[model samples]
Target: MSVLSVFVPVLAASPAAVLVQATEPPAATPVQAPSTKTDKATDETPVIVVTARKSSVTNKIDRRVYDVAARPDAAFSSANDVLARIPSVTVDPRGRIALRGNSQVKVLVDGVEARPGVLNNLQASDIDHIEVMTNPSAQFSSDGSGGIINLVLKKKRKDGLNGIWSVRGDDDGRYSANANVSYKTGRWTANASVGVNRELTVTRTDGRQHWQTTSGLETTTGAGRSTTSPRSSYESASIAYDLSPKDRLQLSGNHYRPRALSKDAGTVLITDLSGVLDDHAESTVNPDRGEGGEITAHYTHTGAIKDEHFDLDITYGSSQSQESSTHRLSHTVPSQADQAYTYLNNGRDSSLTIKGDYERPFGTSRLTAGFQAEQNGSDARSRSENIAAIVPGEADIDTAFSYSRQNLAGYVTWQTPLGRWVVMPGLRIEADTWDAGAVKRNDLRFLPSLNMNRDLSDTTKLVASYSHRTQRPDVFQLNPRRIYWSRLYAYEGNPNLVSQDTDSYEIGYEFADKGFSSNGSLYYRVNKNPQTDTRRVTADQVVIQTVVNADQSRAAGLELTAKGKLMKKLDYSLNLNLFDSEVAGMVGGETLRRQNVTYSGNAIIDYKPRPKDWIQLTLSGEGRGVALQGYKTGYYRLDMTYRHKLTAKWTASVRAFDLLNTSKQTDIFVTPEGDSRTVSRKERPAIMIGIARSFGNTGQ
Candidate 1:
């Protein structure tokens, strides 16, 4: 076994003369500590720029590092806010993350998967750094067809006790408070963090749909307004002990609780050439609550064998959630009717994972091997009943389903260095077993990966990689149950769905000089059984939206990014990713294919007028592109922030999000039968002010 390489943390911005990267030349020798003796020249002239303004960017063999702790926006309360500031990363209106043009990404905290919404619970200030791995190696997990994102948390340093506390508030009635504390003694250290937040939000949506009927095309226009208030609390603690200089053990635990109260009201008008046929109004009240916790134990032993390393980790996690909603509908014209319904859902899941890895380095060559076994079990029950309605009611609307999944995987990788070129070859084998109620599936899969890097110059590198990956269907997706939102709309999962497989290849060039850095890559991917959301209209005029696996899909894209300083006092980062995708599949026994070209870009500019003041402006947008069953419109947003250090221990900041209020998301769906629907959603903008104070010194 061998240990992973230790790369210094660096920012991911383009190189700028005024903001140099923190990494040093591989051939550069290490410098010694300063001594008491001083030369006459040193005394006459002071070295002001000790290390190029403490660069926040670093480039790695397989990923780009972003030192969020070094950025002014790191103090944000949500991971969504922090990730939105990074180039090549996008956060959707629903808080989902997308890398490049793909959303099937895996997010980890300290090299392990945390609970859902964990990132939303995490305060940006607690993050030490983030690694964006576009192409992962064999040492990592085999999930996520898009990419991997790892968040490294801050640990305790030095001795004694030290901590930081912060409080924030916004005009929308959102407030948050956070505290982090660390204590270190000799060979033992403990770290803990807690955060609590309450958020209130309002949103509006309007859309029109045209349906092709036997007589003619009928139109329906609808408008909706929603208000939601959510409260969340998170806590994490860890303890580390060193048995020897080369042996260490650690235990960590995390817990998250979140609850939300929401209400939505909507009105719809249906008309045809004859005249307005019906006017309908609907209202819904929803309450959702969830709690999750994770416990992990890890042990690492280095130098157990000459040039060898060993690591072991085990984790257990569990979550429980429940949601209840009540809907009331009233209609005027075309036979007036009033209906009321109640929907209840309860879900619980648990996971266990055991992983062990070994690594050995021989001269310029390195070898790594790992084995992992994971088991996940979940139980879900949903029930719906009509309290008062004009439609017929069923007595057996309740349904319960249980799912269990097990995956056993092993992998081996070897890295060979020859002159200015390094080549890595890896193989992974996995056996997966899944059981969903009466349905069962088992599969044995083999995946291969290859990567090569060539040093073109002292400041440039050429890299290429290829890998085979799979995206398994989630538990919810494998359950065959109907979830109804209204009389006209319903959603359900497909029990016969299969996994999605992808073959990906990429070639890239990286260059860095002084403070400016840039990279570009071309990638092509082919997918089998690509899962996508689809829309269909039933004979009874009800629309059903569900996840379906497509026959085949292909995507080709180019990604370009640059970051660094524009001037001595100005810093900027930018990224552009463009792709063309095509999907061919059978819908309603008819083969259909659609092709689309899409792109997204992000630009950030920071200005420091004084040592104590920081101001930043960011613009981001995505171009219109194809959806699983239809297409989506393009959208953009603008945001700004200003921070001032009131004193050495105090800081104040203000931020404005979606200044233009144009960050709306729109999508249009068209079925093979000529049935079409359009949906548009927009969230209200927000302005926030925050204050923070820190005590003690943890060697920040």
Candidate 2:
């Protein structure tokens, strides 16, 4: 990327001549400043005037980039907070993220795959920008059928030592601290960072179930309260050496440890047509611990020609986790013997990836090619034990399994200008093999993609694209062992599940001028063998949740976004999405079809009361979500933040989340055998305050 600087004279506003530079053009245009000069003859200064123009959103050929620093509240926010304000993206109060109504989205940091819980620990100040790729090219991975979101971390290139440190705490017993430092000398650069966080959450849940018994209608009601606390710590280091003016070698490594504990107290009542059949009080305790680490090496060589380079990257990662749960039930209504249940589970995973890419300019066009290979393995073991005084014939479970997968892929793409349009077409070929206990499978696929862009005017453009994507089942989804949540509830995976494939098409229009910009798009997608969850009840009244492949599915949507300055001191952004989806599949030996229309949107407003102080407010919500068996209710939330620059090196911020206390969620499930409903709510709103300090010419 290249930085452009422009100078223009305008009427004087503050009697100061300022030079403005565009970092990421063409979305961010230079702000012409006033240039004043006194006439030697009359000693009178001429007046010049100008206006400032900036935008946080940037539209690209295959993706959209959101500048994190452009947001007013980014100084003290988390990665999840930034994602909620992005167009076509949704984040729930529980920190679950979804893109375009799809939850199975891939997330990356600094062009590398991110580990679980990494995003939660990353602060907005550490990120330079975020990229959303709805329809990526053949050079990217095809793991996520929904799309991809990548976070680019900030890099310091100053010739001296630079560092930043910050600490934050919430009213709900949650706290975090982070520190980062970078040093550059001669041809060598080194960077190091450390972070630690403790999160506390409290929730309440209520559920009701209705079913038909041999005698008559039966009903079950339950209510529970739970509290969870998770503590995590991480450390990372990286070093890069310039072998020559055109060659570079870099190595990096990271390690993290996460631990959590949860406790729940609830009561259940079972009743038939006659009256209450059974009632019990239950208490459960769960503890979990995990550790993960990764190391990567990268080498890059720049050719003599412009836009020509060859790169190689190799990475290895490993993780291990263990969890245990204990539950005790005491009879209430009909005074019976008490029961105790204990469950233990352990899991381990390791993966290695190697990738290489080459790019060169071809006349007025460009050519790019890449190859990738990956190997992954996982192991899981679980045991369940039950001890009852009166309940007999209860069975215990012990199971262990191992799974492995290997994948190799190659892709090539060519970009050329045709008349008024720039067209890029690409192809990708992949071979995959998987082995899990008695299940073994092999797959070969060929994927194609095309993208075209035409300039209608200096400030307007049109774009069209098409791509084929695939998503394979993860290890958790492919395991065949059963895990019991309660005496009457269990979960199992499907080893026979196959990969899901999707064909996506999109057309869009973009317009930018002055200080405003707008982007609108229409997209359609068709899916084959989409994966979904299904529930079935056995003769023993146990509910089993498992995964299955749907016969067919389709989705169509329209997305609109606009960002501009409402006034000299105010800027705003608005986003809206409307879509309809339909799916048909077989569940519990019955064919079922589901369809619905949904809408989601978010709005952000920033106000600058003073040159060194600013405040921001955000509101986001979504409509009811459609599911294979039922639907999930919609909800909206309000967030506010205030920031003040104490000095050039110090900053202070305060933030509040869920101001309206409307983060509750409800899920309904209806089937031929029974109907169920569940509602969950957070205990209280969250408020946080933080302060940051920077040194050694670090840009804020």
Candidate 3:
């Protein structure tokens, strides 16, 4: 019995070394009436083996962990292709992820929290492996300002059936297909999945602006081009149950639809005079849809208060949404304008959350405490119509609007570990209530946080942090419609807004071990009472622009990420982020400053050569710089993927998204309309391939 007992033959067939007598098992010789063990509750809390937590201790510094079932040569199909490997994480222009450069984050898959919450629901070949906490502890839910990207999803740690089925095709015009199914027994476990897609896009632009108005002077110049064809679709389903080992249950459903058709014609000059119509007769078509479902129950408990360990969760949910728009505007000075808008949003957001966490192991130290509570709600119905001159002596006008809102929040967190230092402290308090039948809005806010880390050994690490953040105003942008005439451009809704505060500072450095890792950070942000608005013009009045607090802004950044294993079957990753922000300008009193720069990134390379055999190359990108007035117009892109592992439970993959076909623009140049307008962004082209087969511990 050597070589660790022949490399652990189940720890030498341990039942405590047979006879189940490793130590203290012979003292259970007393029995009284009523015994049959079925719901035998007597402070019972055994069975603590875990699958979702991902075992293995200690991963100093950049702290890395990835077992996509031992890699399988991981070629990445989604789950953001394994989050493009952390560090400054970005996938903006609406592709999600947006970390260090901030796209107003917060995305979680397993622990819930995912929606049209600004980011489109999912598809990355139906994910697995995407965890970029970027210094998140204190029991999470800090509402991602550029941190936190969970997305776990992939289970069944043992006892039977596993699944996956795929079909993919691409060259960027878009096409896709998918399916996944699962099962596990031994206290129960279950899963299900489905998918579909489509795509086409193109765009171009040029501009110049200078203006001074009060019934005064103006000069504007422009250039234009556009082509967009889109038809996108998706579907989702989920179920999970494990009633022991600390209770768990879940149910989920989702659906999304996108339809687009556009042919652009542009030319408008107020002073220099330049007009040409029928660039496609200014045609536009768009349609969006949404559906939701949720029910969850989770619980965790541990005792020996003198040594602390506790966890808990309980949640309930409901949802609905629909949107419609029809527009046709041809103004080469002909007088035929057509517009139709329909928005019906129903709501039921419910919450009764009570979370508590306590952890203690103080010697070489570790201490933590956490708390949270939330309740949310919303309701909507708005209808608008306009027809100004349709061939005859035409005249038509109609308007109807309705809105409602309510929200509540509470938060607390603390952590400590001295001697080689590690400390975190937090506090959050928010209460916002609103009603717009033309008025009723209340506000309350308080936020604070601090973090510090030190461990100059085991592969170096040192970090620091300070935070305070807040932002609220969304839901038809506080629906108080100022103007709505869309076939493209002319959307305004602002109900006198308030609430935008931010203060941040950070310093960092981290280096990891084993397969290799790299980290870097530098951050600064300052914002206060920043909502912004001021746009006025008369003669019939279109006096738009709302949401004010008079600007004050600043942001700075730099980030980098790296990966390893150049051989041993090749694996690579590279990530980068760069940002510069400033806004403060006024021409009257003479005080000006405006600066913008943003660049986001992604890179990947994988090769198996053997094992299960695989091949891969991926590159993803986003860019923005040069913007003003609703600031849009920013673009850059690249994508490609290929995978093959035909046996050991079949596997296949193929993908192409925006592959060097970059186009995005969102509209600006409003020094009160000296003119140069027509902006739009958020277009997707997809191609996906699939074929999957797996069973039992596909989780390895």
lDDT of 3 by residue, 28-80 (tens): 43533333466535223232221122321123322234444344423235455
Q: Please tell me which predicted candidate would have the highest TM-score against the true structure.
A: 2
RMSD of 2: 4.0
**Per-model lDDT:** 0.81, 0.83, 0.53
TM-scores for every candidate against the unseen true structure: 0.92, 0.93, 0.29
Answer with 1 or 2, whichever has the higher lDDT: 2
**Candidate 2's C-alpha lDDT?**
0.83
Clashing pairs in 2: 10-48, 10-49, 11-48, 11-49, 12-48
Where model 3 places Cα greater than 4 Å from the true spot, the runs are: 1-81, 84-90, 94-97, 100-167, 170-200, 204-590, 593-648, 651-678, 682-689, 692-700
When 1 and 3 are scored with lDDT, the better candidate is: 1
Error of 3 at 79 (Å): 8.9
Which 10-residue span in candidate 3 carries the lowest summed lDDT? 1-10
Off by over 4 Å in 2: 1-55, 69-75, 387-394
Per-residue lDDT tens digits of candidate 1, residues 343-381? 899999999999999889978888989999999999999
